[model samples]
Target: MVFDERLVMAFILENAIKYGGKARSKSVLGKILSVKPEYRNAIKDLIEYIKSKIEYVNSLSQDELLKLYEEYKDYVKTPTKAEKKSPLPPLPNAEIGKVVTRFAPNPDFVLHLGSLRPLIISYEYAKIYEGRFIVRFEDTDPRTKKPKLEYYKLILDDIRWLGIEPDEVYYQSDRLELYYNVARELIGRGYAYVCLCPSEEFSKLSKSGVACPHRGQSPSENMELFDKMLSGEFKEGEAVLRIKTDLSHPNPSVRDWPALRIIDTKRYPHPRVGVKYRVWPLYNFSCAIDDYYMGVTHVFRGVEHKVNEEKQRYIYKYLDWKEPTYIHHGRLAIPGGILSKSKILKGIREGLYKSVDDPKLATVPALRRRGFRPEALKNIILRVGISPSNAVIDFSLLASENRKIVDRLANRYFGVRNPFKVYFKRVSHIDLIKIRKHPDYPERGVRRFEFRDEYISLYIDFEDYSNIISRDPFRLIGIGNFILEEADKQVKIRYIDNDVKKAKKEGYKFIHWVPVDHSIKCIFIYPDTTYEGYSELNILDEKVDSVIQFERIGYFRIEDLGRNNINVVFAHD
Candidate 1:
C-alpha cells in the first residue's frame, strides 16, 4: 500500500501547533500506524518519508502550521492521552502564589541571544506559578564589569520587547550598604575576614590549600581592617574581603573566595554613582544576599556558574539562610554569531561593529532589527528548555519559524532585480491589471496598475528572464501567458490567452513582473551584498519596518523609506 505523505505532514503540523512548534517523530509515527495498521508492515520504508515530511512541517511558523492544518486536519488522528503533555516541565518545589524568580543581568553590555535562556526560563517559571518575576541588575563590580548607564534602559527595553515585564527591579549598586552590612555580620561571626594580602600572593595560598596570613586574624582585627578598607585606606587590589570556606576543598577557587574588593573609584568612577563608595561586593557575595532578601526562590543560571553556586552556598550555610533552588542549564551558542560580550565590545571599539545592534551580531537588539520576531526567539528558548547539554541555534530553523509568521501577514509585491525590459505585442491599448494583496486572504484587497500602450512593457528580474528565455511560452504572474518572440537589445513577446489553469497543467514556470512606467525604486540589503531592483509602485505605501513578500522572491523588511528609493532587508525565503 502506498503511504499518504500528506497524512504524515498533517499529523506533524497538528503536533507542532499543539506543542509549541515542534513535532515528535515517535508520536507522529504512532499516530500514523494507529490509523493505518497496514502501513506498520512497511514501516522501514515509510520512516524516512515520514521523517522528511515531519522536518518540513516542523519548520513552518505557527501561522503556517494553522493554515496547513486546515488543509490536512481531516487526515490527522485524535491525539491519545499519552501524547498530550505540557511543553515545559513544572518548577521543582514551586508553590503557586508564593514562588518568586529573578533574572539577574549585569549591565556591562546589552542583552544578547545567550541571555535569553535564563531570562525566558525565569520569566516562564514565574508565569507558570503565578508568582512575581524580578529583574536585578548585578552591577556591583563597577570597576571590572562596569555597568553603562545607557545599557540599563536598553536591557529593560529588550526584556519588555520579549514580553517580560518584571514585577520589581533592583540594582545591586544601590544595595551596597545592605551587602556591606551582611559582610560585617559575616566577619563578626568569623565566617569572613578582611584580607590585605595581594591577589597574586592570595592565589598561591588558595591554590596550595594553605590559609592566608589574614585568615588567622581575630574578628575584631578583621573588622578594623574592613573599616579602614571602606574608608579609602586600601587601594585597588590591596585589600579584599574573603569568605571563610574549606581551604582544603577540591576546587581551589572556592577555597576562601573573595566576597568584596576595594576599587580605586576615583580613577575608574562608576557611571551610576561616581566615587561614592570605595568598596564593592563580588558576584557571589551580592547575588547570595540579594536572592535571600529579595525573595528569589529559584535561580536560573548557566551551568558554567556551578562553581559560583558552590561558593555562594557557603554564604547561605554560614548565615543559616535557606538557599534558593538552582537550575543550571547548558550555555546557548550561535554558530556564526558573536555572543561574547567582551569580544563584541572590542569589535565595536575597533569599528568592526557599528554598535551593539549591528546586524552581524546576535545581540537581542540586532536580531530585533533584523526582523526576527521576539515570539520566534521565545519559542526557540522554550523548546531547548533546561537541558544540561548545550544547544546550537540553527539559522534555518529560525528563518522557517519567522517565515511561518510573516507569510500570512506580509503583502505580496513584485520586485525585479537587475531588471530587463520586455515588450508584449497583441495587447489591449489600455487595461488595468489587478493582483491580490495577499494570495491567502483576498479580502485584504488588490493592487492595480493601468497599462496605457498597445504594447505592454514590463520589467522582470534578469535572473528570472534568463531562466525562461529559451521556453517558447511562460506565464506572467497576475497576467496572461506570453510567448517569447524576440531576444535582441530589447526583448519582445506576444500575449496569449489568460488561462492560469492551462499554465499550471502544463507545469509552465511563472515569473513576477512590475510595470515599467509605474514601479518604485528598491534596494534589497543583505548581510554581504545588495540587490538593486524595482518593485511595484504600491510598495511605496508600506511603512518602514513593515515586512512584505516580494512574489517569486523571499520576504523582506522595509528598513528605510527614502524619497528616491525603498531599502529593505532580506529576511528569508
Candidate 2:
C-alpha cells in the first residue's frame, strides 16, 4: 500500500470547497482523492469529474443516460463500490453492525410475474432495517445472455415504478477470478474434490448415496485433478468440483453437489470481462461466495429456493461466515393456471397472449395499464395476507380487492358493446339529449347527449339482448329517460333511449349508453351492460381489467375496434 499525502490533501481540499470546513460531508469526493496508504490517486480525477458536472448532472434525463455512460462512468462505478463521502455515524451499541443484502436476478430474460415478489420482499426487508440492498445480475447461462443491457435499464425502471428501487448494482460476471480463487482454495483444503464421475452414473450416485471412483482420492490428488478440469483437459461434463460431504445423511447438504463446471468460454464471454477464463462456478457456489464477500445478512425468498438453501448453508459454514437469515414464503399462485416464466415467455413467443402485458395475467405493469393502482395491488396482497399452506387463490378475489380501491374514483361512462342499433322516428326533432352522468351520485356531474331522431341508435351487447324476452320496460340509457316499449320471448327488450331525473319516472331498469357524436374518434362507451350482469356475486369485469372508464358506467373502459376487426374475450358473466 503506497502512501500519498497529496491525494488525501486533494480530497479534503475538494470536500472543503463543497461542504466548507465540514470536509467530512463530501465522503464520496474525499474517498475519491484520498491520499491514503495503498489507495491509488488514479481515481482522484473522479471527484473533479463529479464537481465539473453540477449543472450537467441536474440536466441528466433518462433518455440520455446511456449516452452519458462514457462521460460519467465514474459516477456509475462509484456507487457500486462506495463513493460515500460522509464519515461513519456513531454506533448505537458501541458497535455499528453493517447488514448487506443482494437482489440476485438471473439475466436470462426480462423480469416476469414470478420474479418480482421475492425481490420486492427482500428489498423491503433490507430497506426498512437500514441495510444495503445491491442488485446483482446472475448471468451464468451463456446461451441466454445478452449484451444490450437495456433490459437492465428496464428492470431498474420497473423497480422504481414499483417503488422498490435497488440501492446499488453488481454483476456476477465481474467476479469470475474471485470465484476461481475460492474454488481453488476449497480444493487445497480438501473440502472439495474433482469428481470425474461419468454422466451415466450420476443419477445412481445422487439417488442411492453410493460413492463413485473419485470419492476416495487424497487432497493432493484432488487438487491435481481440479487443475486438469480448469485447464480444459477434461470434456464439458466429464469433470466437476464436487464438495465432499456426507452423501448418506438425510439432509441434501450432505449430498455431494457440483460447485463448478467447465463451460464454453468463447461462446459466453462475460459481458464486461469477455472470454477472460473458461471454467466457471455454478450458481450455488457463485451465490455463496457473493453473499460472503458482500456480507449479506438476510435472504428472503420463495420456498422454491429452499432446496438451494439446504446445501448453500454448508458453503457458508465452510467459509466461517454467518449464515444469512432465511425466510421462505409460499409463492403467490393463481388457480387454474401456472406462473412459469418459461411457459409465459413461450406463450408470448408463440403469440398466445399478444404481448407480456396481456389482459388475462395480473402482470404488475399490465395491471397498472389496465387501471390497477399501485397501492391497489399492495392492498390486495396484504388483504390476502400470509398463508403457509400451498394456496391457490381465485383471480376474482384479486379483482374484488382492486375494485374497492378504484371505487368512487374515476368519472363513470356507459359502454354499449356487441351492438344492436335502435331508432325512433318520433324523437328526431327533440333538441334536448337529457342525461345525468351518474344516477346514484348526482354530485358527480353530467354530460349532455345528442339525439337525431331517425338516426339515433343504442349499442346493446350481444350476450344480454341476444334473448330479449323481458316482461318490463327497459329504461333508455344515457338520455336518462325510457319506456320498455317491447320484449321478445328471449330476455332482450327494445325501447326508446330516455331522459330522466328519477328512477320511478324514467322507468325501473337502468342501462348505459353513449351519445352518437363525441369529440374523440374512439367510441367512448360507458357501462351500458351493467344492467345485465354475470350470475357471480360481484360484477367485477364491469369494474376491472382492460377497460378504462370516463363515466360511472358499470363497465367504463370500452376497447375500440380497428376498421377490420373487433374481438373481446367474453366477460366471465
Candidate 3:
C-alpha cells in the first residue's frame, strides 16, 4: 500500500500548531501509525520519517501550518467542534422570571480570579433565567478591611469588562439607616438583645451555652438600650447588638451572633461616609437585611460561608422573611497564585510588586495586563459550574483557552531570540516576500518585505543555527532553500533552491529568518521574566495592543514603550 505523505504532513502540522510548534513524536505516531490498522505495518518507517521531518514540521509558521490543517483536518481525526458551555443547573424552587441573583464583593481590594468565579456564576445564572442581577458592595467595616473608594469604581469596570452590567447596584455604606432600622425591629420584637458583657466573659458564656445577663432584658428595655447604643452614649466595645439564636446550638459560634457594633469612627473614619454614623452592621446582619429587602431570590457564595449562612438564617427567621435560596459552591483557587488581599497589599507596600497589575499576581488587573481575555475567564467559570468540589486551577489551562481564542486572529511575525548573523553567499536578484498579516485571514493583506539581494545577511536565532546539520539543505521559511556551509560563531549558508516541495521531500529542516537590515529590537515581558530579541521591522508598524504571534515562539501583545523600543507582553505559546 502506498502512503500519501500529504495526509501525514497535514496531521503533523495540525498537531504542531495546536501545541505551539512542538508536537511530541509519540503523540503524532499514535494518531496515525497506531490507530489505523492498515498503517500499523509501516510504523517503523513512519517513526523514522517523523524523526527526519519533525524539525521542519515544528518550524512551519502559523499560517503555513494552519493552511495544511484546513486542507486535511477531515482525513485523520475530525477536529471536534468546540463544546458550548451549558447554563448552570436551575436553582431549586426558582421561578423563571422571578429568580434574582447577586454578587456582593467587599470593596477593600481589586477582584481576583477567585472572586471572578462568583461574579461569572451569579451573572450567568441571572442571565440564564432572564432575571435581575445585583452588584452590591459590602463595605460596612471602617476599621480592618476598610473599603477603598477607588476600588468601588474599578470593580464596576471589571464587571463591565466581563460582559455584565448589574441591573441594580447598592453600597452598604449608603444603607446604614436601613440597617439601623432593621436592627431596631429585631430588638423591638425581642428576637435580639443588647450584650454588655466584656469580650472575655461573652466568649466564655457563648462557649458554655450560657446566656449573658443582658440577654434576658425586656423588649422595652432592649429597645431603650439599643437606642442609647445607636447614639454616642455607648463607648466602643462597651455594647453590641446580638441576634438571639438557640444558645444550646452545637456550633458555639452560632449562638447569639453579633449583628451590629459601635465603631470608634474618630480613629478609623470610613473612606466614603467618614464619621457620619457610629453604629455599623457586620456582614451577616447587613447582607441578610439587604437580601430580604432587595428581593434577592438566590444567593451564590463560596462554601466557606456555610457557617455564615447558618447565622443569617436566624435573621430571616426573626424577621419572618423568606430566606434567599443559597447555593454554596466550593472555593476556586489557583495553586501557587497570589490570591490573598493582605499578601498582595503587603507585596505592594514592600515594593515586591509594582502594582496590583503585576504579571505575577492573579488579580483581575494582573490577568488583564498579562493579556488574558475576559472570554477565557468566562469560559473557565461556566465550565466549572456550581459543583461543590474545590477547584485548584492550573494556569496552563487558562493559557490554552486563551490561545484558542487568540490563535484565530493573532497575526504572524518573524522574531528571533538570542539572534545570530547568517550571511547567504550565493548572488541573486532582490526578492519581495509577501507574508500574510493573519494566516487564516488573507483579506487582512500581506506584509511586504524586501530582501535586498541573494547575498543578504539575515538575523536568525543561535538556537536554530545549533539545530541545523552542516552540509544538509534547509528552507529559510519564506525565502528559499540553503545548505549550512558553516555553523559556528557566524553562520554561513550557500543557496540551494527556492522549491519548498524539494526541501520537504528531502526532509530538510525549515527555519525562520529576518533581514538583518530590516529588524527592530524587541522586549517581551513574560510572567516571571523578560526577553530581549530582534523582530522583523514590519512589527514596528503594528499598533499598540495588537496581539501577534512571534512566529514559532508565542503570542504577544504589542505595547508602545516609546523611544523606538517595542515592548510586548507574552500571552501564551
Candidate 4:
C-alpha cells in the first residue's frame, strides 16, 4: 500500500483518542496495533525526510531552486544519508572528549505533561554522564517571555520543586552579541546571503524552495544589506539574512535558511537588550551560535530536532566551530494522553480547565495533587535509559507504576460518600468511637478519626450494594468484620472482624466509608453526587496530585478552609 502521511497520522490520532482511557473497545485496538505496529516509526521517518528535503531546497539561490526541481522531487522520497564520520573541526585534537548536557526549560509556564519524559531522561543522562546541567532561557522573544514578576515566578519554583534544577543558569538575551558576530562571520565567508523576505512569504519558501529577488546578490552587496538589517534598516521581516548553502543537498534547513531578522516584534520589550537591538537570530542560528559560544560539548534535544542536528552542522562548518556530539531523544507522546501543550493551553484559556495545573489536566501539578510523587515520574521515564529508540510511552505504564509506588507508602484512610446513617441499634446510644487512623502503621503519624454510633458513614460501592442485601457484618477494614446492612438508603452493624472475613471468603461485596460519628467533622465533597449504588464513580479525578488522601474512601484535598470548619473533604476525581 502507498504511504499517505496525513492519512496515517489522522488514523493513528483518531484511534489514540478513541481507544484512549478505556474509552473504546480493546478488541478493535488489538486489531489496529496488529495492523500498524510500526506507525510511529513511519511518521518519524517522514518528518526527518521532509526536514532534509527543505534544507536541500533552501541551500540554493532562487534560480538554483529552479534548476533543482527534479532533485527536490527525488529528495522527498527519502533523505537518509549515511552517518558521516566528520570530526568536529573546532576540536580536532581532542578525542574521547568529555561533554556536558542540559534541559533548558524557561520556567515561564508549568510543564505540560508532554514535556515530562524529555525533562526526566535528560536529567537522567546528565546524571549518568556526570556532566554539568544547565538551565538556559531562549528568552530573546520578549513578546512571549515572562517577566520575573510575582505572578510569573511559579514556573521556576515549580521546576525546583520537581527536583530538576540545573547546575547553571543562562539566558540567550545575555549572549546576543555572540550570535551577531557569528552571523557577521557567515556573511563575510559567503556562507550567508541577505534577503528581504517577508515572514508571511517565507513560510511558503520554507518548503517551496522558491527564493526571492535578492538570492543572486553578491557577497559584497549581501554584506551591506545584512549590516543594514542589523541597524534596523528595514521593518521586521521586511529583510532577513539567509544562510548560503546547497539547496539541492537533500536537507531543507541547510538551504539558505534565515539566521537573522529585524527584532521589532509585538511582544514585551526585551528584558536586557531592549529595542536597541533591531535584529534577532532565528532559532537555528541562535542555537548554533550559542552551542558553540558557550563551549557546549554535547547537544541533546528532542528527536523532533534530528533535522536541526544535521543542518546545524552547517553553522559549525561556516563558523569553524566543532560540531557538538549529537543526541536526539523522541518527544514524549503518551498513549491515551492529551499530548499537546497547545491543547492544554487552549483548555486553560477556554475554561475547560482551571489553569495549566488544573487537577483535571495531566500537568505536573495535577499529578502532584493526585498523590503521585515526582519520583514516580522520574522512575517511569528513566526506565529504559537513553537511546535513539525513543518511543512515545503508554500512559497506562506510568499510571500503573505510580499506583504501585503510592499504594505502598501512602497512608490509608476510610471515607464514605452519598452517605446515609447506618443505625447501630442501642449501641448507637454511645455517641463516640475512635477509629485508629492508619490500621497498618500506627506510629507513622498520630491522627484518630472520631465516629459516632448514630452517624457512621461508609461508601458501599454501588456495585457492592447491587451485590448484597440486609444484615451484613460491619467491615472494619483491616480490623475485621463486614457491615451487615442493606445497600438501601443506609445500613449499620457492629464493627466485627470475623464475620467480615467470612463474607470475603463467600465473595460478599464490602464497601468503603468514613465513620461519620467522628468529631473531627470531615466534609464529604461532591456532596451532591448520585447515590444509585456506586454507578457514577469518578476515578480519573483521584489519579492526579500527590498530597491528598481519603483513607479508604479515596484521595482528596482541602480546597478552601470553611469558616469555623477545620476539616474539608474534596474528591480527587
Which candidate gets the maximum TM-score versus the true structure?
1
Clashes of each: 0, 44, 0, 70
- Give the TM-score of each candidate: 0.83, 0.66, 0.81, 0.69
Candidate 1 deviates by what RMSD? 13.1
Cα-based lDDT at residue 316, candidate 3: 83
Per-residue lDDT of model 4, residues 33-110, tens digit only? 333343334555644543443344345454554444433332122111211221101111112224466565544556
What's model 3's overall lDDT?
Answer: 0.82
lDDT of 3 by residue, 225-316 (tens): 98998778999999999999999999999999999999999999999899998999999999999999999988888878889999999988
Tens-place lDDT per residue, model 1, 287-330, is 99999999899989887898999999999999899999877777
Ranking by TM-score: 1, 3, 4, 2
Candidate 2 residues lying further than 4 Å off, grouped into runs, are 1-101, 109-113, 143-154, 202-212, 215-231, 251-254, 265-277, 346-351, 383-387, 425-446, 452-455, 463-471, 484-507, 519-547, 550-573
lDDT, model 2, position 23:
43
Clashes of 1: 0
Compute the lDDT for candidate 4. 0.54
Indicate whether candidate 2 or candidate 4 has the larger lDDT. 2
lDDT of each: 0.84, 0.55, 0.82, 0.54
In terms of lDDT, the poorest run of 10 residues in model 1 is: 77-86
